[model samples]
Target: MKSTVETLSPTRVRLAIEVPFVELEPSLKKAYREIAQQVQIPGFRRGRVPAAVIDQRVGRAAVINEAVQEAIPAQILAAVREHDVKMLGRPELETFPELEDGQPLKFTAEIDVRPEIALPDLSTLEISVDELQIADSEIDEQVKGLQERFATLKTVERPAQDGDYVQIDLAATVDGEEVPGGSATNISHEVGSKQLLPGLDEVLVSMSAGDANTFTSQLVGGDFAGRDADVSVSVRTVKEKQLPALDDEFAQLASEFDTLEELRNDLRERVTRVKKVEQLYAARDKALAELVRIADVPAPEGVVREEVDHRKQAMADQLERIGASLDEYLAAEEKTEEQIDTELAEAATEGVKIQLLLDTLADAEDVQVSDDEFGHEIMHRAQRAGVQPQQYYDQLVRAGNAGAVFGDVRRGKALALVMDRIKITDAAGNELNMDDLRGGSAEHDHDHDH
Candidate 1:
């Protein structure tokens, strides 16, 4: 076998391969044997039919087609390995040479290859991370959130006010024509919550039970068109939320804590955990941005365009699932498809730059994921995503995205290692505790609910 490779672009290559007839003989013989077992011919028993007889029965074209189908993929893979190409996606096969008896086979394949990256100087980079001090107001807000979660709804016999819940039947019309997805009955909506739409809560305010009113307002974030909509709402009942008193009894009823102080302490710890996670994400983003800024290599334009197109297709799919077209969504958002494409293209370019930076760092640090670590990470993610471990693993493999998952974990590890070697300080100029940033011993456990 002989092969030649041509660099079409930074991220693409064209391969021309020529395999001698001798190299294809084994596959041809195997194809002939498989055909003989399935084919039937007069005066010849099945599985005992000679190759020439089977060829005569099935035709030479059929045998050659089968042979090519069986041989091409392996031949392509062998050629790729021989040439040491880092393929990013599937190759598009083209330009098949006509096969002649006892003649060599020739073909060409075009592939998208992974771009090579060079690492930048890590010592010269600097990143600023916000070091916010937990405030008393934040803790109080968290406690209030807990109280709201345990609040109860009580029916009231008066006009609805702000923060009151009203059960109503609603319908919208444009020029007295009923609109799709604009009618509902027995729906309980809270005034001042803004859960329904922006001016809907105000429309229901000060309305008593059994009051029916028609108002006009513009529909937001939906398929409805026009600048304004005519909405008819009838209040069936008014209700108020009665929050439980924040005391020892409430603490015991809501959680394992027996006292309000204990509950507040637990809430503080949970808030701290959440804030730490946010800080980690911020630091990661800063590090990646810095890396991209300092890296010298330019990202391949083809890869960025491909990523942008992928994002657009994904957005289209999401719109279809919600019974809306991309045009409608863009109009609702007060934007055009070209504007969206421009935004996505910029984002995709940044994403490609960041990926290349990470790959370079991984290579410099010799970062790798062990089998055990990969399994643990996959299982952990599956549990968090509320999926079975094996099912999520299969999905990652099928989408050709397992490398992405591994890349994330590898980049995270590499960043952590870089942090360890750097001089990190808080806003107050005090040395930061890297240990505090990386201190978590909890291993995720998988659970499936039926």
Candidate 2:
């Protein structure tokens, strides 16, 4: 087989392959034998038919077509290897015939190739990261939030007031016709909490138990939109929240802390950890932005196009999952597909640029993950994802995404090196600790929304 390559673009290539007749002859003979075994002739046994006889009966074109199908993929692979083309996805094949036996098998394949990238100067880049100090008031507020979580709801024999919880049955009608999704039975609603609707909370305040009231409001943003709704609600009971006493016993009951002071200390540490993580993220963002600004390298167009296409497909899939058509989603979001694509193109381009920049930095710095570091990182991610480490590893391997995990680690190490070289300071000009920022706490839910 002989091959030639042409550069279509910086990120695309075309390969022309020519296979000699002798190389394709074996496949042609195999095709003939298979056909003979499947068919019967007048003078020969079913399995004993000759290649010439089978070719005469089944046409040379059919045999050659079968042979071409089997040979094209291997030939393409060989040609790609010979040309030293680093391809991204599968190659598209187009074949043309050269006459019989001693003639060549000719085909052209178009493929996306990985672009050669150059490393940029990283030592000259600078970034500023803010240092945050945990405040006493913030710690107190977090403690109050925890106490609220342990609060009890108590029945009250009085009229329902603002901030009181009320159990009620509600129904709504518009133009004397009952509106869909405007009714609920035995639902507990907090007056002035704004849980149900905007104005409905105000209307529920100051009503006594067993009282029925009616009000009119406009429907908001869903299936009965743009119509006035007349609603009637009857209160069955009124209740108030009774918070737990802020004492040593209360702290012991709420958490592992034995005293209120201990709990407050823990909360203060948690707040510090959270602020540090936020600071680290902010610093990373600033550093990346600076790198992009300083790096003088062109991104591969193929990577940018692939990223844009993947993002569009993801958005389409998300809309489908949410029970909305692409058109409906675009209309609701006030954007057309083209408009979305245009908006995402810049971000996609930047993403490819950043990837190439980081990869180059990793190479320049000789950043690498040791086996221990890789294991630790994988286990840490698995713990955060609530899965076994081996399970997550197996999943990454199966999906062919194991390289992605290593890429993330390498990028992180590269950023750390960049951070070390640059001077990070707060707005007040004090030095900040990157390690403190890196070792921050994860978020925990104190309420359903949190």
Candidate 3:
């Protein structure tokens, strides 16, 4: 087998491959044997038909077609590997010659490929991100949340009010017929939550126990979605909350802390850690955007368009699952269809450009994803997806998506390497460290080279 690559552009290529008779012999023999077992012969028993007899019955061209179909994928893979052509999207078969007797097989494929990108000098690259800020109010909010969780509920003999827990029997009807799955009895709800139905809060206010009222709302989901529903509610009980005072006793009851000051300090630390992680994510994205802006890289038009189409299809599918359409989404978001298209195009172009840049950098730095890293990634994703790790791995392998996962890990490592080399300063003029991403535990070594 022999293969050659033609540079169509920096981001595209044409692969011309030729397979000699010796290389094609195995596939040819297999194709002949498989076809012999399938096609019935007048005299010969099944699976015992000679090649000549099978050829005389089934055209020689049919056998060659079958063999070529079986041969092209392996041949294309070989050609791509031989030339080190990193293809992006699907390969387009440009030409395939009709095989003649004792002749070599020849074919050509055009593919979108990773362009040779010249990344900006990482050491010289500089970007500034927002300074870390954790407000006292944020910590107070966390403390308040904990207090709510430990608050005691008291049965009150009064009308419903905002912030009061109410137990109610509720049902929804459209045109005097009950909506499916829209009725509940003895449902406990916060009066002001408004989580169950819109306009429900307004009816519950000042309504005492045993009070019955009806309010109109538009259903957002189910068979009768978008239809106006008459929701009737009968309050069974109204309960008020007695929050534990923000003191040492409350702190001891709520957490492993003996004092309110210790609990507040812990919450502040947690909030700071969360904010720092957010800062880390923002820095990576901002840095990548800056690199895309400064680097000598051109987004492949074909790849960008393909990405745009894929995103649009995904969006459409998502809306379909929710019983919505593009028009409805547009109206809800107050965006025009053309605006949506523009946004998708912009996002797709940037995504492709960033991917190409990271892939090229990964190659330059010899970035690799180890088996242990891949396994960890699989386990993490499976946990998030609520599936077993082995099941996810098998699904990925079956879908030929294992390479994509490997590529993702390699690209992440490439970005982390860039993070190490680049200069990132906070708004306060202090050098921000990527080490802060791991909860500020700077004593541990990073996963990538410095």
Candidate 4:
């Protein structure tokens, strides 16, 4: 088999291929054997049918068609690999010819491909992020948080107030029908936290124990989502928190530190470490945005259209499962379906551009992901997902998604290479050493959740 490519656009191509008649011999034999087993003959058994007899029975055209069907897909993949074509979606079979006795088979496939990108010089770029600073007030706040954790809750007879803990029963009904999973009994909530139903804090502020109040709200989850309902709350008990004094004794009781000053100093160090990590990520985001703005990569329309349709259909499916209408969901968000679709299309285009750019950059940099690095990533991810590392790895392999994980790790390393070439500084104009932040390892340790 031989293949040639014709450039249709920057992100699309047409591949023309020719296969020698001899190459189809194997597929032709297999097709004949399968056909023989399927067709009934007068004097021959299923597996014993001869090729000539079957051809005379089933026609030569049927054998040729079956052979071509088996041969084309494999040859298409081979041609793509030979030419190093970064094809996106499935190739469209544009044209093929009717086969003859000993003729070369010719076919054409048009595909959406990844475009070659002209990246700006990373060495000439610089990004500025906020300076890493941990203030005394911040340390004090952390200490206060510790104190609250050790605080005692005292039951009180007074009405619930802001910052007071309240035990209450809550339920919601839509048109007098109780919503599934929309009721809770004897649940504890903090007043003014707004962590419960909306408008619940206002009603709870003046409601003493055993008092009940009802407010209207729209259910945002479950089958009754997006429906207006009457939510009722009945307060059972109210309690106030009494925090311990900030002293050495309190520090000894709350933590390993024996004194408040030692605890505050520890908190300061913790805050500083957290701030540096935050700065590292902020610089990465700013640098990536700057590179994207300068590169202006163009994504193929076919890939973008497919992604947009998939997302739109997924949303429609979720709403359908919940018994909600598209119009109702859109109305709740104050957006029309057309507007939502346009937004999805735009997002998909941007997403495709970023992915193409990173993949191309990874190739250009010759980045490689080591098993150690890949395993570390899997371990951390498994921890976050509350699963064992080996289980997660097995699941990914079973689902044929190991390639996606490898791609993520490779793309992250590519970005780290960019981070090294580009200059990064704090808002105070102090140049940050990427070496220090990376801690003498490959700088790809940066988050790749993007």
User: TM-scores of all models?
Assistant: 0.74, 0.73, 0.83, 0.79
Which ten contiguous residues of candidate 4 have the minimum total lDDT? Answer: 440-449
Model 4 TM-score relative to the real fold: 0.79
Winner by lDDT between candidate 2 and candidate 1: 1
The Cα error of candidate 1 at residue 392, in Å, is: 4.7
The true-versus-predicted C-alpha distance at residue 372 of model 2, in Å, is: 5.0
Model 3, span 1-450: residue lDDT tens: 888899988888988888997788788899999998998888888889999987889988888888988899989888888888887887888766688867988888898887777777899988788988888888889999999999888989999889999999999999999999999999899988878899999999999988999999998777887899999999999999889899999999999999999999999988888787777766777888888888867787778888999899999999999988787798779999999999999889888888888988998888988999889878877876799999999999999988878877788778879888988889999998777665653222122211
Clashes of each: 0, 0, 0, 0
Candidate 1 lDDT over 1-450, as tens digits, reads 899899998778989988998888888888899898898788988888898887787887788878887888888899899999987656778765578878888899988777776665666655566775788889889888888999999999888988888999998887777778889999988888877755677778888899998888787535566557888899999999999998999989889989999988998887777665555555656767766666654566667777888888988888888888776788778998889989998888887776666666778889988988888889888988799999999999999889878877776567666666655555666655656655442331112100
What would you estimate as the lDDT of candidate 2? 0.77
What's the lDDT for all of these models?
0.77, 0.77, 0.85, 0.86
Candidate achieving the largest lDDT: 4
TM-score of 3: 0.83
Please state every model's RMSD to the true fold in angstroms: 5.4, 5.7, 4.4, 4.4
Q: Where does the lowest 10-residue lDDT sum fall in candidate 1?
A: 441-450
Off by over 4 Å in 1: 8-10, 27-70, 93-103, 121-123, 134-137, 150-158, 171-183, 197-199, 216-231, 240-272, 297-334, 339-349, 384-387, 390-412, 426-431, 439-450
TM-score between candidate 2 and the true structure? 0.73
